[model samples]
Target: MRTRTEENPDYCAIESAMEVLGGRWKLAILKQLTPGTLRFGELGRALPAITPRMLTRQLRELETDGLVTRTVYREVPPRVEYTLTDAAHRLDAIMSQLDTWGRWYRDTVRPGDAERVT
Candidate 1:
């Protein structure tokens, strides 16, 4: 699928960024990797709501976007791990700001609407 960034050369730079990180799960995945490397199953455990299939799909997209690196170890059980790339690390401050804003929104704007927010 051709994204808006690809089809419209005149699109804003933010559009290009959103193309890679705007999805519901991409930011979450990146946030999970902020601490350090984690295996596929470890990621799944952290994000209990995401199915194995969806987790795999999001990880693949993150890898394609150069936000995450996937490494495979030829161990006895064949281990695989993922780590955030330098580009992704650069967003740490931004992500922290977003988290603070999200907390404010949930607390002030939608305090009693937890059911609908979910």
Candidate 2:
């Protein structure tokens, strides 16, 4: 099925980015990989809330999008690691701004609601 972006030819650059990073798990996965390369198991542990299947799928999609790279080593027990690409690294500033905005929004807009659980 064609997504909203696929159907609309007038999407701006931000919309294109959102199409790539809109999913629940993509941003979290990217954040986890921002530090350094991590094995599949390490990623799973870092994000215990994500299922193995979902993690694998999100990683594959990120890799395909040129935001992440996957490397495999040949050994007695094969090793695989994932890391963010330069393109993804370039997003650090934007992500930081987003983080700042989140904090500001929480403090200014939802000051007392911070402790409230969804």
RMSD to the hidden true structure, all candidates: 4.0, 4.3
Error of 1 at 66 (Å): 0.4
All candidates' lDDT scores? 0.89, 0.85
Score every model by TM-score.
0.86, 0.78
Give every collision pair in model 2: none
Error of 2 at 116 (Å): 12
In model 1, the Cα lDDT at residue 31 comes to 88
Which ranges in model 1 have alpha carbons more than 4 Å from their true place?
A: 2-11, 111-118
TM-score of 1: 0.86
* Model 2 residue 25 distance off true place after TM-score fit, in angstroms: 1.0
Candidate 2: tens digits of C-alpha lDDT, residues 1-118: 3155454457466677787787889888888888899999999999999999999999998897889999999986999999999989988888878779877776677656755534
Residue 80's C-alpha lDDT in candidate 2? Answer: 93
Task: Give RMSD (Å) of candidate 2 vs. truth.
Answer: 4.3
User: Candidate 1: what lDDT?
Assistant: 0.89
